[model samples]
Target: MLGIGIVGLGYWGPNLVRNFSAAAEAEVRCVADRDAARLQKIHSLYPAVDLLSEATEVFQRSDIDAVVLATPINTHFPLAKMALEAGKHVLVEKPLATSRAEVLELMEIADRKGLQLMVDHTFLYTGAVQKIKSLVDSGELGELQYFDSTRINLGLFNPNWSVIWDLAVHDLSIFDYISSGKKPVAVSATGISHTQMGIEDIAYISLFFNDSTIAHITSSWISPVKIRKTMIGGSKKMVIYDDVEPTEKIKIYDSGFSVSSPEDMHRWLVDYRFGDIAIPKIAQTEALLGVAQDFVSAIVRGTRPISDRESGLNVVTILEAAQQSVKQRGQTVSLV
Candidate 1:
């Protein structure tokens, strides 16, 4: 059994602890939080679970075979590096690190130590997303044209990172996974900060890829109501994945544009073909739970996670570039 140590008991930490504790292959050995009151509260709920104030104490214990980091964005790099160096497998939340160099360093350390390093990109493990991946992989999304997404919420603001890192990272990771091996060539972005927090509350990012593929992502935390939707358009078909919907969460539309006749030239008009819309029977499972379970499986099988370090690195690399672009007033940034 993998003995796990959980760091940070803030917003997302408890979910990790609960899921990890429930996984059969792993056991939550201890949990650490800086706030003593929060630790007491957790101890009150999970009486048998060990709780501590200092995060370093978890690393000091030999019983911990792995560490799960649910800390803030800035703390991810150092905490993950420390955990890996302590000879423990590490699982960190999304955007693995703030910078590309930090990601490379973490990869090197984990590789040298022959340890597993996983990132919690929770959405990728979702039933809807997995089905979408299968559809794309099976050529149902044929010759991808563009990916457009809009993710907005009222306010779960962060002081460290802008809206791009806070919100668009999810779509970026999804696009990365869905696009397979396609690397983005260039990008442009713009953002606005409504508050005095010094970080952006809204942003729009455009990603340019080789060939005809391109993607646009818009994220904001200042919206009135939450909206989570993504559309992937292709030559053959199109897809609409809406998390806000209950019945039609994922709808694959067998409808697209087609040229009527090349001979007509200027007279020729684009045809709109509409056919079947499939929801592709999907299993009901919590995304975070699936991610936690997958982490354990990857550890046991000695395999890289689906949303592994490399995937997280790619997302962070884009985020870094986008941040730079935002600062430069949406000047096109090149990834190559």
Candidate 2:
């Protein structure tokens, strides 16, 4: 089994620990957190696992073949770099790093060390998203025309990053994955800070692709109601993904419009067609478990993971461009 060490026990750390512990090919051998209470709680639940107050101990231990980092956003690059330098595979939480340079540095280290460097983009492993990817890849959705996503909730303000970095990052990853090899050419964004913390609580981003495809994302931390929805429009069909729905999370619409030439030279006839909507049944496996399995498999098989360094780099590049656009007051920033 691949021995795994986890850093951080707050927020999303516990889920990682649970999934890694349950993975058949992997085991959570060590857990490190500065918070004494969190360590105590982990020890109480998992007495066989080693607990460390300092995360550096996790890197020093030779038994740990891999390390999963669920630490704060600012700590990801340093911790990942240290792990890769120590010859340990690394799985880090999303956005990879705040800047493209940091991500490239980590990627270079991982490549030199021949270690598996994966990013924990949990949403990509979700059943709904998996189904959506299948549909897109199978040409069932035809050529994608536009992608629009909205993810907003109240009172989960992050101190280190703005709403765009915190929330829009998810949609960016999703867009990157479903778009396959298509890359965004330009980005425009706008955001505002409402709290005394001086961090943005609401933001909007728009991405432009070379195929004339467009994507818009809206992220907010002060919405009255929670919403996690994405709309993908194509030439032949459309899709609506509502993450909050319990049973039916994905609905595919067989609807589109067509045009016909009229006798008049200046006027043409437009035809609209609305067909049946189909809801595909999705498996209900836990997404974190899938992520854990993929991480361990990548390490053992010496293969690139679904959420590898390149994917992380793409997401981070978009985020960097969006941040620039926001700073320039919604001026379109070129991603080229």
Q: Which candidate is the best by lDDT?
A: 2
Q: Kindly list the per-residue Cα lDDT of model 1 for residues 166-218, writing each as its tens digit.
A: 88999999998987757899999999898888799999999998789989999
The lDDT for every candidate, in the order shown, is 0.89, 0.92
User: Best TM-score goes to which candidate?
Assistant: 2
TM-score, cand. 2 = 0.98
Distance from true position, residue 250, model 1, in Å? Answer: 0.7
Which residues of candidate 2, in runs, are more than 4 Å off? 261-265
Residue 211 alpha-carbon offset, candidate 2, angstroms: 2.0
Give residue 86's error in model 2 in angstroms: 0.9
lDDT against true structure, model 2: 0.92
lDDT of 2 by residue, 59-117 (tens): 99999999999999999999999999989999999979999999999988988998989
Q: List runs of model 1 lying over 4 Å from the truth.
A: 260-269
What is model 1's C-alpha RMSD? 1.4
